[model samples]
Target: MNGKIIGGFLVLSALVAGAAMYYLQVYAFYRPVEVSSPAAAIRLVSLGGVQEAMLTSDFEAIDADSSPLRFRGCFVTPMTLAMLSETFETYEDPTPLNAPPWFGCFDAERIGADLETGAALAFLSEKNIHPGVDRVVAVYPDGRAYAWHQLNESAEK
Candidate 1:
């Protein structure tokens, strides 16, 4: 009886430890990044491919008043990631998602409806248009974007 009780306790403890580790990792790696200001947001986005980016005013109604700058892309590149990390201010996010292959994530104070809508759709879309999207970007005022296709790795390995 004593041996059986000890074994059960050990098993339970191991399971609990495993779960705690997973929770911590998910939150740490996938937390939203904090930005210092709107300029930082624009500067970060500018470093990436801007050919597909649309002006917030032209794309949506919420950002009509914010016309001091221009936006041109939805995603950022490795060349810009390091520069962006330096440009933006990030902190510990209270909540994070549980997705596999988490590359990184950040929170933006300002963003347009189009980007938010598109990113959310990508996350919940039926078709896997952007597979390997492990990281997420939580936009303020209810917006979100997830990063797919990590740049650290090569396409043809």
Candidate 2:
């Protein structure tokens, strides 16, 4: 009876270990993606109408003309993407929903950061995202924009 109990325990342990490994390898690791440049993002949005580039650390993206309610759209950087992946490492992917799985954690206000843009750009280059700089486009009221240009695999989210 003792031997049977030990055998059952071992089998349970193995199953648990296997599940842990699968989650760690397949889901936990951050799979870096190459995001498009801010210049490109600007250009894409400009196709609809003239758009402005906001990358300096001194000022946040905003429209002084009106009471800024929300950003119309966002041009996410590779570094920012990495940050999000790390931030939501354990978050369950909101699948079967049409919206972005990780959008829940994204804050548009954070993207206007000029102070961290420099550091973030450096990190982006190391991750193989070329011309790592402020590839930021903040959509304000009356601002024209394009669809989000992400380089990561959608299924991963």
Candidate 3:
């Protein structure tokens, strides 16, 4: 009778310990941190004469101007892609933040092309403009355009 009671108590304690370990691993260890920021927004002019806008950070607060369409997602322009790839590689982590499974394709050459194209697009978009081809244009935020051009020229290798 004594032996049977001791065996039952051991089994019960083992089950409780296993349950606690499972709970901790599932709920406490694998959660991702929430992101907050300067609030990135993207506005695009589609080829069909439609203007699309997207807001990141808090996607629920989307509003559309003119058309009844609104978007709530991050833009993956060339610059952003290059930055993300570089960040991931710099960290030397096999897995990167918000990276897709096939992110290995973003080598140095690909990142350079993406950054150049993205920078051009960003410059045009700042002035509510768009470029027909992938070319760089220097723009200043405070309506002084010459500074960026001068900087770019000086930085050229």
lDDT of model 1, residue 125? 11
lDDT of each: 0.30, 0.29, 0.28
Tens-place lDDT digits, model 1, residues 9-107: 999999999999987644433332233333223221222322122112111101112221111123433323233334443212212322333322322
Judged by whole-model lDDT over C-alpha atoms, candidate 1 comes out at 0.30
**What tens digits encode model 3's per-residue C-alpha lDDT throughout 1-157?**
9989999999999999999987653343332222332213333333343434422232212212321111112222333423322332111111111212222322323333433553312232121122212111221122111000011222233
Worst 10-residue stretch by lDDT in candidate 2? 90-99
Error of 2 at 126 (Å): 9.9
Clashes per candidate (backbone, < 3 Å): 7, 3, 0
- The model with the greater lDDT, 1 or 3, is 1
Name the lDDT value of residue 137 in candidate 2: 30
Query: What lDDT is reached at residue 72 by model 3?
Result: 18
Clashing pairs in 1: 32-106, 32-107, 33-106, 33-107, 34-89, 53-72, 53-73
Predicted model with the maximum TM-score: 1
lDDT of 2 by residue, 1-157 (tens): 9999999999999999999987664345422222342322222112223332323221212111121112123333322434322332211111111112333333433433421342122111111122221122322222221122122233234
Off by over 4 Å in 1: 37-149, 152-156
Best first by lDDT, ranked = 1, 2, 3
